[model samples]
Target: MSDIRINISNKTYVLAHDTEQFHHAIADLDFTVHPQQFVCLVGPSGCGKTTLLNMIAGLDPHFEGQINIGQATQSPTIGYVFQNPRLLPWLTVRQNIEIVFDDKPPTSLIDNLLDNMQLFDAQHQYPERLSLGMQRRVSISRAFAINPDILLMDEPFVSLDAPTARQVRRLLYSLWQKRPHTVLFVTHDLREAIALADRLIFLSPSPMRIVSDIEVPIAREQRTDEGCVEAFREQLLQNHPKISELL
Candidate 1:
């Protein structure tokens, strides 16, 4: 499937303890994600960005909406990377990754992925022994093991130090270069979204609705250098000063 269509008419929740209170998380939001497109959803903390991603992955199906995985008959396979590296402490890194696949993938395939993720040296190590950055790498590796049609990342780089986050972001880009998937990434950082996304979508406060959808015309290669990244940052802010309101 090359395109994913999402339409949400309404999504609401009620506080169980208080029957009179009702909360709406999303409303009348619709968007399409093209193949290999990296789309970032940015909003304040309670804007339901992660809630929307969860709906797309079928992890939470209570929302009133439609998520079509293009032409696929069965539900499209989805890979998800949560904010935390939820790795199994008892398993080796390689084993943790392998567990996702129904059948064994070629040894070379796993090896190549681990090597590219810089986890080949740490593959035998348990999650508890690895640094947080390494643990996140292994988490990413496990997600890719299934070759998902769409990958959902919910604040995957949150809580990392700047240097570690930069390393992991580069590793993510390298992996995506090898095999690009339709990606939906949720982040609160405006600059981070600007740096990583092919398309940047800004969301309003709760009862989340898209405020603006902007495309990044600059190629990823151009943004690789530190100079280019800052240049692009200036370009975005200058062109769309409204983005600053959220920041």
Candidate 2:
């Protein structure tokens, strides 16, 4: 388990470098993600959720404050799942997954992931031939194969149908349990946030800042069922009025 600490005074991107005009993206954001914790960042579109994730992943270094991930050193091992399954169309499903690794991971790990993700049958198939859901599954398998210490996901289920999203959520839960990592998942949907997060952090629109930090006590399984979902929704609406407004 690795602890994380983040303190961002501001996130600014120059819109017109020559004119020195900039867009203030995020401001005064402070938070922490405990080792192996599943934390969700929820806000309206264009908020700094993805910006923050990118900073943590070390993609954008032009931020104001400090982000101290556990064991501050060289780069940390990170797994990223984007809104789309960014698989290599030319590669076979198995090859697409293995390409991410610099050193070869054990055969058992690869076999287990392929078996668990139900991609064994499609391992030799190219990404273009598989259904969207199957391709996303392969993408997920690829992420886990790297054995990441921190996993960053940006609206991973965005374009999927409701049923497909639910199915993926279940598979995600199973995968997380198998190898728990410090996960920072971003989404604009509050309902989806409730379903996946052990801790919820809500952000305001850009320039963004933390508005609410909540610990979700509801069990993951309970949060997904129909009756329990409504109950959880009502509880959130009562307790966090701001969250409802954004939703």
Candidate 3:
């Protein structure tokens, strides 16, 4: 797959009641993510992170500039994991993932995805029957099952308890290692961003813009070590004091 290029000059949302009023969401933001790279967009809440992801995903298009995924001759598959686990209550875990494909996908594919997410035993259970963590795993499994060229995750683990969130993060990293896809994950948590991203893109408050683009120095394996990540974070803030205030 080709790299994902994003260039945004301006993006504004009109207020529902007032046509004259506009909410400036993003401006003068530009970045390109290489294929199979994991990048994190770190910003304060309501800093237009989700809006940018929506624009890239083609969910919202009324914005200036463009987002190109892969090559023009190829159709890039895009997968999204939103803030919540948006699963169909009626569908079992396996069925939820199966529904993404236009045709019936191979049973082996479904089994393997469930197995990887550690949900094989619960594959037959409905969304309502599973815990929040389990449901989130199903969501992640479904996203990867599509074998997306670009994966956009918007704080998928935000609502989980700390322990559960850590578990999910490790699971996501394991999955990404097995099948590396171009990923742009958005989150406000600096520690989470440090733990997952290969590169970190810090954004200004809305109308959002890029403030800093940094390559994560800690190795992927070392990220799981809390002391390493924490030390790096402390040094990072000490070096870039401005970024400290942005978050």
As for model 3, its CA RMSD to the true structure in angstroms is: 1.0
lDDT of 2 by residue, 1-247 (tens): 4578999998899888688888899888888899889999988888877778888888899988999987756467899988789999899998999898778757788889988887888889998899888888888888888889899998888888989888887788888888888889998777778778899898888899888898888876686676776687789879888876555
Model 1 poorest 10 in a row by lDDT: 222-231
The sequence of per-residue lDDT tens digits that candidate 3 reaches over residues 126-226 is: 99999999999999999999999999999999879999999999999999999999999999889999999999999999999999999998988898999
Where model 1 places Cα greater than 4 Å from the true spot, the runs are none
Task: Give the C-alpha miss distance for residue 1 in model 3, angstroms.
Answer: 1.5
Using TM-score, give the best candidate's number.
3
Would you list the clashing residue pairs of candidate 3?
A: none
- Expressed as tens digits, the lDDT of each residue in 1-247 for candidate 1 is 6688999999998857658788899999999999889999988898888889889988789988798886766668899999988998899999989888778666888898899999998889998899888989998988887888899999998988988988889999889889988899999887677678999898988899888899977778865676776787788779877766655
TM-scores of the models, in the order given: 0.94, 0.94, 0.97
Give lDDT: candidate 2, residue 96.
91
Candidate 2 off by > 4 Å: 17-19, 73-75
Candidate 3 local lDDT, residue 61: 93
Assess the local accuracy of residue 61 in candidate 1 as a C-alpha lDDT between 0 and 100.
Answer: 94
What is the lDDT for 3 in model 1?
A: 86
